[model samples]
Target: MTTVELPADAMDPTRDDRKSAKIAAGRVRPEPGAREVGGFGLGREVLRSGQMLQAGVSGDRFSPEDRFCPVFFLDGERHKKARTAIARYFTPKAINTHHRLVMERTTERLLGRLRATGTARLDELSYELAVAVAAEIIGLTGSDQATMAGRIEASLFATRVGSRNKAVRFGVGLVSALHAGRFYLRDVRPAIRARRAERRDDVISHLIDESYPDRAILVECMTYAVAGMVTTREFIVMAAWHLFEDDALRARFVAADAADQTAILEEILRLEPVAAMLHRRAERDVAFTGAVAAAGDVLAINIRAANVDPAAVGACPHALDPDRGTKQKQVGSFLSFGDGSHRCPGAQVAMAESRIFLDGLFAVPGIRLERAPDLTWFDGLGSYELRHAVIACTPAPTAD
Candidate 1:
């Protein structure tokens, strides 16, 4: 193990400044260690090195069974096979063809309702859109949209059992288990039955065709549903908040075409990525920065810090610049999507959904935040939640 001494500036009062200071210092001595590596350059190197393995392989705190079979937890050959099988559904082309219309329609419906209602909670709308897209992709569209969305949210809430108090943790865990079981039985099991009997052009149908057991399919659905619903929901609100704060960026995003909107979406994701950190475990001895990581050592890649690393993004990395060129000659160099084999497979879907939703959202007249959202951070995996993100929209224009 190795430790790097921090300078006085590293003790800056603000959290963001302190993080930046640490990143600046780490760039000077990029080493593999238990402590977080901050800069995008350093973090990217660590992620792409192939020395680190998915942290979920060690055992997921939220669900221990994830280590065995979930796509998120598997490593090496198993991971490759599972990811490749499901990969086609998430491709840019596939999403555009099979699911893009679903996303667009969902966004239009939600935003249209918001425009009529005059005031709406952005987080709720985001969750609804995310659920609809995820559900449609997985062939779980039998349930009503709101009911399905609620079930997904409940399932996610059941996973947050990170409390210091033993009793509280135990109580939450028990409740979470019940909620998760209900979700599996009510929402997931029915979809599995339907898909198994009559396959469709969706992920569940693919799994059925492959003859995956109900338990395996349930786990996979849980993984995708929670990930798809929570991350995208948070990001949509975060991106909208950023746009609502800046007039120029908002105007540019509103007028940008799909190609440019994709770029803007990438940039927004870089600045306010939903995942604050990417966790990895060392597979063998590896030296990084000033530290030597031995086998089984866990490393937390500080995504927020790294995304703004000047070495990668270049000057004024902290500033939100949509046109910031890709770093190190790599497209989408930001670690918002992790690097290496474990990179998020649903990256394109999330980006496309966000772009489509924003297109519908900002299309309305006089769209503005009714109240600033209260941002809260939870313990498990550094999850960020937005509360009270009320937005006001004027009525849609009438046809001439």
Candidate 2:
């Protein structure tokens, strides 16, 4: 297998210079023939094709027996069945009817706290909001919002083991497993028991009605918690950072209604997707966009690059254009939540949470960035995280 040596900065999604340079090279060469690009390639065509399968079995980390194995890793009828069973919970109707109130309340509470404090870290506020919404949806009601958020954050560090030595990875995985077990015992198990005794409309209840084992239920909850909490938190911070830095965008977003806000958020996600790289493996020999892959080959789909591919997103793909006219003919289109069957079920939920949170955040007069945040990447997953996103806010005028 040939390897491609990408510059360190190429993996940092916020570093447009290096990322654009690397993407330019892919556009010119297209990774065809014997010049394979070490599993990392860009372009809409590469992602939409049927040659690749979810990268679940490509490594031992996601063995079939793993508790975290959800529909995301399954294929064919198995995947379809699992996704079908739970699809209703994430539909727009379900989100609006069941989860919307939770999101609004959580956002209001957090923003109120920020307004009172006058200075706060955006990441902390975002994380709290995300955890509250996700926890409620997953039926994790035993723990307070702050405690659940801390546990979820600690458990997510396991994802950082991607490139570590086997010994270190093993240690990290062990610690992560223990943390997850504790979270399940403390927060999830009680809810699971309650759901079993009397079913509800939440995800935990759904899992019980489906007859999932306790371990599997815990895994699924963990999966949704991390997916919902971490990604949404990062996107919230990133979107706010962009809006705060750009007065025109902020003005437009603040003035626009919820629907317009959704579009603006999609555009921001298109530019700065939280998970910039998605891994997939070939199930059999395949060729596309001049590149050929044998069975069992792993490919890293550069989501950030593909989202901005000129051929796909049209002129000035890098620019943050909420009104960027949709081109119907594009292949991959937007991959912020990925494409195809394994796409995130909580896409709508994440978007809703972001819109509600931002709506409340920007409504506070004098709310502005206290300092610029530093964006860092976890080499293990090609994902970005923000630090020190301090925001200064004054309490909104109290009603008479």
Candidate 3:
């Protein structure tokens, strides 16, 4: 191996690479400079731009009173305050203290089921594990986790019955609402009631203490539901697919330390972010580097393209390199989780849970991918979902 020395500062994050990395025959070198804008410079520009309000989930369409929505959509001080109050649940100390055991036990149970069944859908198992772990963190322990998982998944990812017919559209909307309502009633309300009587260190409890109405609390629950459960589940299937398909890479990942395993996972996420495009609307005209957005102009931050931008990511932006982000002193997942004020607060939580669960998953003896998942585009969140990923493992020996 040859060592390539890099300058102290690189890429001049403000100065555009202009796709130079893509044109430079799969490699581009970085030069030292004031490059605080590390991952996806333009994406960072809009994300950090004080002039932009989140447009995802129609946040910009909400009136001021209705802005008490998900932290993902809140702007300015409200966003900051909400983020602060809810910060405790996602902090490193809190995750370790409150969530680690749940993640471990959930992983074990899921793996045990996989072993006993000999064959199972990786996506299904991942969904259950993701829901179980996230529900625990959100204080959503009010109902059967599996039932709740099914409800939320049905609400979010159920096939969008694409029809231009007004009547058909109404039916689809009604079904979706019913799914959402069931989740709220069966999962969110119970948690809220329980937390009301006795506060706890969880997202639901915090929202209740803040005097969030039941409707707002339900919205918040749905937000965490999608953010925590859906995204994590997809990532697990994606990571497992990559590992099971590559013998050498799988070996490296399986034998790696916790930090190394996480890096590998982040690298994969960089290549395949669950939310490929994050929408933001400009509250005022803003300019950064080579781009500008006017007030009320909707900006689609292309996370997928940004992740591969050669200028920020540096050389072979397409290849998997666990060390590249770290070598450049960048977050391993880059802008995969997002950037700036609205950056996903649960990044550390997601990374920890994913690493823990996947480590156990791949460690199963004779575990092998039996069928690949069907890939489908989901416009609801601007991402992809993988389903029907079947894997087989040696059945656990029966107790005599």
TM-score of each: 0.85, 0.84, 0.87
Better of 1 and 2 by lDDT: 1
Give the total clashing residue pairs for model 1: 6
Tell me, by lDDT, which candidate is best. 3
Find the candidate with the highest TM-score and give its number: 3
Worst 10 residues of 3 by lDDT: 27-36
Better of 1 and 3 by TM-score: 3
Give a tens-digit lDDT track for model 3, residues 260-284.
Answer: 9999889888877787667777788
Q: Model 2's lDDT to the true fold?
A: 0.72
Per-residue lDDT of candidate 1, residues 237-341 (tens digit): 878887777676777788888977778778777766667777777889988775677888877788877877767876666555556654335455388888888
lDDT of each: 0.74, 0.72, 0.77
Candidate 3 to truth, TM: 0.87
Question: CA shift at 107, candidate 3, in angstroms?
Answer: 0.6
Off by over 4 Å in 1: 1-34, 56-68, 164-167, 287-291, 326-328, 396-400
